[model samples]
Target: PAASKNTIRVNSPRVRCDSASAEKKKIMCTEAEIEQKRLAALAKRRQREQEQQQQQKKR
Candidate 1:
């Protein structure tokens, strides 16, 4: 009975470890996507500023 209990305890933690790794992967993917969006926004802002400066020079 004690051996069966020990086996159950080990199995439970292994299952939890698998789930935790999957969750970590999901979090990493989201973080990467957020970083990409932030970079794109910065690039767009820089382009707009450059365009404004060009218009000012033309005027």
Candidate 2:
């Protein structure tokens, strides 16, 4: 599956991880969790860009 540029995949929810950590693993996630992470990342990126623009305006 091809995710968009800003999407993050840390052990895809579709795949199972059966390493020594399987006991500590949860393969499936709620839609809310996925969307929350994506939104947080996007907000962080936007903030960084805004800060960069402000710095450029100062210079």
Candidate 3:
């Protein structure tokens, strides 16, 4: 009975820890996606500005 109880206790926490990590991973994935999108937008804006400056110089 003691060994069985010990096994149950250990298994419960292991399951809980696994679920917590899974949630954390989901949040991290969303954050990474958002960062990628933001960086892409900034890069596009910078390119547009450079093109405009070149156009102005042609005049």
Tens-digit per-residue lDDT, 1-59, candidate 1: 99999999999999999999999999999999999999999999999999999999999
Query: What digit string (tens of lDDT, one per residue) describes model 2 on residues 1-59?
Result: 46653244645542445453454543334556888899999999999999999999999
lDDT of 3 by residue, 1-59 (tens): 99999999999999999999999999999999999999999999999999999999998
* TM-scores of all predicted structures: 0.71, 0.50, 0.94
Best of the two (1, 2) by TM-score = 1
Each model's lDDT comes to 0.99, 0.70, 1.00
